[model samples]
Target: MKKLLIGTAALAMVAGAAFAESHSVVRLGTEGAYPPYNFINDAGEVDGFERVLGDELCARAEMTCEWVTNDWDSIIPNLVSGNYDAIIAAMSITPEREEVVAFTQNYTPPSPSAFVAMGDVDLSGSVIAAQTGTIQAAHVTGMDGATLLEYPTPDETVAAMRAGEADAVLSDKDYLLPVVEGSSGEIMFIGDDVPLGGGIGMAFRKSDPEMRAKFDAAIQSMKDDGTLNEMIAEYLGEDSPAF
Candidate 1:
């Protein structure tokens, strides 16, 4: 979802001096619930592609960094409230979000969104599930004759479909691929893959251009030396998109 201005003061801060000070320890906010992108590992630590990428960017930028978990619905607002210095969540760069924050250059190329269902059911006029506040949710909302069931987490979206409460669950193909493969013929991909959002990028409060620039340069460095693509393959599989 696009960042919502929490209040008049929060709106003013976003418009005024949001994150003006240099942070010695830059806090990266993310949705710890999103897998492949991010998740709390069995060890109860933040672990995934973003965790690895965030650490490398912090190292290349020569800054001490820490990870902070937030629910996806409020991730952007927490950054605006100074709860974190930046968002490294697998957030797509979109004009609606750009109005509230600035994005570093994309770290991953645009990825397609897709749907999963039990059989060859048509999606038109069917009830579809999507994580609340996600591009998938917004897309399903606008689909002709489609009914949307929104959940707070990605897992719930899939769960609803499994329980037969939803005809299908829509999300990033990268996130759904493993689930479909593991379903043992119970679930399968359906319908055409839908391109959604721009490429994924890190976000900073608009006032924190310096912090944004630091990571942007670091991301470009990774892209230049091929470390970024290697990491993407390591975590997101060989077929995943590179910079």
Candidate 2:
């Protein structure tokens, strides 16, 4: 009985001591324009839900994270070319993307990606706006019923739609969640397919199994500890985007 108790105590110690491996510096690339998910501040600091989550993941993994802000269009390519180690921006995992890079298992799942169209406006037969080079943009443009007007970013697309220069905008659900709730105006989810695959992930060049493992452990730790959802709530508001 004493031997068993000692063994149990040893196992408990091992479990308690279990922790994610740390990297010296995990370079995190963010769009720094997608509000609530990731964005830049007046101070030029990258700050948002993704930013908060990155910090937490670093803490959990015991790594130092270097924040890199750049345009959304270039983020994934930069990752593949080793310009940055990982991406924490509001990027979803899709089959096409999987061809170029690997993603950490999804940490936060979001509502389906779709367009928020005005109720009274006839949105059909009109050009839909979305950020250029985004998965949202591709989805909208490729849809059988859609005619797409591409913009540079989510903010620009929203502006064009609000100005009636475009019919509606396609985006991730959480990114538009704030605008929809804040406005008293009516908005509707237009299509059957939201978006396929799963939630946003930390992307890395394929074959970097070591780096992937580090991030996987880090993200899983955050999810298990509730750090991930807490950051999302703080930035994107209380409606959680758990894809």
Candidate 3:
């Protein structure tokens, strides 16, 4: 859901020609690990909410596209390096990320973040696990008494909590709710939901305003026609907020 380090200037240099070529087939980058938003299916293909939404957006914009999976840690850098034309992962629109890449309007509204643990425990001064390079991780790091534990993937964060490496795991409430429910009382959510970032949006190279504009328009069209909200419900559940 975020990034840590990237060479913004290098990304801009590499994006120049790609952004200028309007008719080229766009390559969409994603971390095929975040379920509901995206994940690798048993068939070894990217599949989930973003996959469906992205395909629709591409069709609406009249752009041919393909999916490319990359680790969350290097997703942004790869986009800048011309490895992909855009990032359709469930990336939150944050100021820190905006400095390195441009973002389209949010498709999903800002969802609440929550903490999950095996039992009731005080969050203050406790060790917490969060996916590395995410807003949740940054938020936990700055908490007055919390010691943040970072993991490369969301699954690892949950594993850390189960193994007692952390007192709790913090992440999007939507993402955690199903896991908590499926755990059959082994894991439960504690603490109030916290809102972070500006919702989820697609990321583009800073030089790719044209491509960004194409997608922004396509996204707005979906919202106007109720297609976007429908897709959100299909993947994130009926209660999921729309644009």
Find the candidate with the highest lDDT and give its number.
Answer: 3
> Using TM-score as the measure, what is the rank order of every candidate, best first?
3, 1, 2
Superior candidate under TM-score, 2 versus 3: 3
* Ranked candidates (lDDT, high to low): 3, 1, 2
Model 3 weakest 10-residue run by lDDT: 2-11
After superposition, the stretches of candidate 3 with alpha carbons farther than 4 Å from their true spots are 2-16
- Full-model lDDT for every candidate: 0.85, 0.68, 0.85
- Model 3, span 94-168: residue lDDT tens: 887777789999999888888999998889989999998888898898888999999999999999999999999
lDDT by residue for model 1 (30-142), tens: 88888899999989999999999999999998888889999877777778878888998889888777778899999999888889999987788899999887888888888
Q: Which sections of candidate 2 miss by over 4 Å?
A: 1-23, 122-124, 182-195
| lDDT measured at residue 137 in model 2 versus the true structure, 0 to 100 | 69
Q: Which predicted model would earn the best TM-score?
A: 3
Worst 10 residues of 1 by lDDT: 1-10
Q: Please give the lDDT score for candidate 1.
A: 0.85
Q: List TM-scores for all candidates, in order.
A: 0.93, 0.81, 0.94
The sequence of per-residue lDDT tens digits that candidate 2 reaches over residues 116-197 is 7775444456678888776666666666676888777788888888888888887777778777877676656665536444
Clashing pairs in 3: none
